[model samples]
Target: MISALTAPAPRAGNRAPRPIYVTKGGDMLNPFTPTPTDPPSYLAKYTARDTAPGLARRDAVRTLLSWGLEQLADAAELVVSELVTNVLSHTSTRTINVTLIRTGETTARIVVMDTDRTEIVLPACPGDDEEAGRGLRLVASMAVQWGVERVVTGKLIWCDLQEDR
Candidate 1:
């Protein structure tokens, strides 16, 4: 069983971090190997019920902050809260899954996956008087990058953050 994960440093002259996984045995696991059944590398996965979206968001941010990535805690908190709540709002699934990953020494990725088949329309800028509709705005402002992907189960929204250092 894979008990832990770590992202390998980016190669020389490269800015993108290599998404690698480290097991308890200290061996590197390739997430995109020839094996089609291999799961994507992730540090943790939290499952939450539809009745408690806040709890899921809190727990995910807490887990991320605990992984020695305190520098991006605020960003993680905002992104996770927004995306998870969006999932709760969009889908009728009894439960939702939040996946946390360390993509690099100072970078982390948070993905919220739901079972809804509907396409997600990325949020656009909101007006000054708007009270809502700024979830994706917050995500865009803080995340180094953010995007949505269509998966077999449903759609997954993700955001990446990097330490200021």
Candidate 2:
């Protein structure tokens, strides 16, 4: 599981807040500020055999770091791992594709595409004692925006988050 406490925006005064940490093990990191004209960012695609959930997580973290979004690594890793894990656990597909696309200066979309075309059930809040069914909750909680998109071959689960400069 990943945990991030967003830094509250500063009050009426002109003080811009410190970098809102996308925290990892409670450590604060870089700030992401987006300007109107920044170009897109890209991270290399990673393909994983459907059975290898850990590989997906490891590579997701690596990709985020390689893309220079240290601020997003922790949350991105968890989100990618959960999405890939869901495919492995719930579908018969043999492979999965993970892509990180940055459409704006401080914004990125995490895409997890699998050959399974089945619709995904948005995760419902589980009780305190429930051990399962919290994966998407982690994603929805951390990401600013997230959704499922149907593709010609299969469905892609996507989420967008803020990234650092």
Candidate 3:
């Protein structure tokens, strides 16, 4: 089932409100279109390459810091890196779209979309000492909530993190 929380009431002179769907676990299911007056957000597309993850991490950090969300920088950086890396490693997609949205007063959502239709395998515990694996596992642990959804073009994987206050 899908549930949604309406975007917070718009600021004066802002456009009509939009709804953001969320899973029961609090992971965002839909990427809301931002009105001009909405809170800070970052969206960009990157070529699917070995360096994309690092580049995405840099963008994620810069965006968060710009919004005074530096407290989330560490987690956000790791999450963005892992998600982007997963795409380049697992899928044949040539590009990816990364979006960082301010979902609430202290909550932010990171979404990575790739143009591949492969089913996402839920992360399994990697045996210790393995030199690989564990990217998604790290994301699952850090994110307050997260999940993947199939989209017409490919798949959207999102995770939510809230500043500890």
Candidate 4:
């Protein structure tokens, strides 16, 4: 698994940090308040064909931060890129959907849906001479928790992130 590097909290003298909410598709049902029944704070939807240029993933993460999820922006973006790349490389589907949700004041979730239902396995980290095989490892390291769920038409791979409240 790829290890996550945590930067120390900002020094006390710095101004208070701004709220960060990074989402990909869907709308932010609650921008300021966190409620029990409310949906995720940010959402993103895409199709298999949407994975062509990697910038889409970056834009999606930026949108979430703009909507108020700055803390999760970087990790979410990395996860999105790795997951989406896997979908494009392994599945025959032409579209996929990605969503980012703030489940609690200190937790966020990243979900990727694809028409393919095959299980994903992370390949062993290769030597410096190898060109690939490290995506899922990165996901395992960065996410606090993660797994896959089978759906009627496809599957969803999701991960959880614990944030600093």
Candidate 5:
């Protein structure tokens, strides 16, 4: 497991410092902020094929189960499936990397990274009659926090899930 390097002082916004995870070599795992890197709690790379989403979902569920977070399995599975499916549908990238991190005793994070740099756009308000375009909204409803961040190679979309939900 990677150790956290707490920031010595509060950030400019006065928010309490967040735990920063880094490599022993002093390289930041994520450029924008600290996140799990190098050896994530769970990591899997999948080709952008039809079976990719299912496989990713399976891996996420398995990882959560192993961590004794069975309550999050259903939400995590759907979140993983939708994120991976979005990557496959919108990008031509050959592979997608899925990472799951146990943030707390009953909270975990799910991240999907792909080569596509296009920013994700969500509908202002998807109509009930629409057959699609509700995946991200569903994710937003289920997750305590969700967002996308740009990396040097690609963009990673992430969401935080809590067992209470």
Candidate 6:
């Protein structure tokens, strides 16, 4: 299932509020019209078992990000950290899938899928003195928009960050 939520405030009077699209399973929407030359530049898949190896998952993320636009590298790393950490902490599933797809020279989508369907709630950022919290906040701040989508056995959470045109 894919669900959408909009930001609380509107940026313009005439424009309709844009929904922050979220999905769990298969492709939620075809955001792009058919384009022949704009095939994905690189594609990489990682399973849950890959996360067991220390630093392997992080390295995979870094490697994938390296192939795409450079500007989104930091946000990609942060999102990977939070999503992977959530899987490690909240579920017994050891494997999570990460796929990087380059839709255009300046656009890419980072998807993290795990065998848990629980909705991710971005909690309020904690005070500087606090020790925990703030992962999703960082994700929300960095990604253009993100949300969870439920699948048959698990769920997929994805975020998109636009690179320079």
TM-scores of the candidates in the order shown? 0.66, 0.65, 0.75, 0.65, 0.73, 0.59
lDDT by residue (1-165, candidate 5, tens digit) is 356788889758896777865443222222222244433377767767998888788778878887789999999999999999999887878789888988888999999999876766554676889788888899999999999888988888999999987
lDDT of candidates 1 onward, in order: 0.66, 0.66, 0.81, 0.66, 0.81, 0.59
Query: Per-residue CA lDDT of candidate 6, range 1-165, in tens?
Result: 646677577667765566664445432221211112245432233344434323423553555456546676666677777777766666666456665666556666767777765665546669999976877777778777878787887877777777752
Model 6 vs. true fold: TM? 0.59
lDDT of 2: 0.66
Off by over 4 Å in 5: 1-40
Please identify model 3 stretches exceeding 4 Å from their true place. Answer: 1-37
Q: Please identify which of the two predictions, 1 or 5, would achieve the higher TM-score against the true structure.
A: 5
lDDT string for model 1 (50-160, tens) is 434555556555655556778877777778778877777667654566767777878877887777787767776788998888888788889888898999988888888
lDDT over C-alpha atoms for residue 139 of model 2: 87
| Residue pairs with backbone overlap in model 6 | 23-149, 24-149, 24-150, 48-95, 48-96
Model 3 lDDT tens row, 5-118? 788899999976876644342122222233234766767677788878877888788878777788899999999998999898889998889999988877899999999988
**Of the candidates numbered 2 and 3, which has the greater TM-score value?**
3
Q: Is candidate 4 or candidate 5 better by lDDT?
A: 5
Worst 10 residues of 4 by lDDT: 27-36
Q: Per-residue lDDT of 114-133 in model 4, one digit per residue for the tens?
A: 88766655467698898888
How would you encode candidate 2's per-residue C-alpha lDDT over 124-163 as one tens digit per residue? 7799999998888788988998998888888789998776
Give Cα distance to truth, residue 69, candidate 1, Å.
1.0
Residue 89 displacement (Å), model 2: 1.1
TM-score winner between candidates 2 and 6: 2
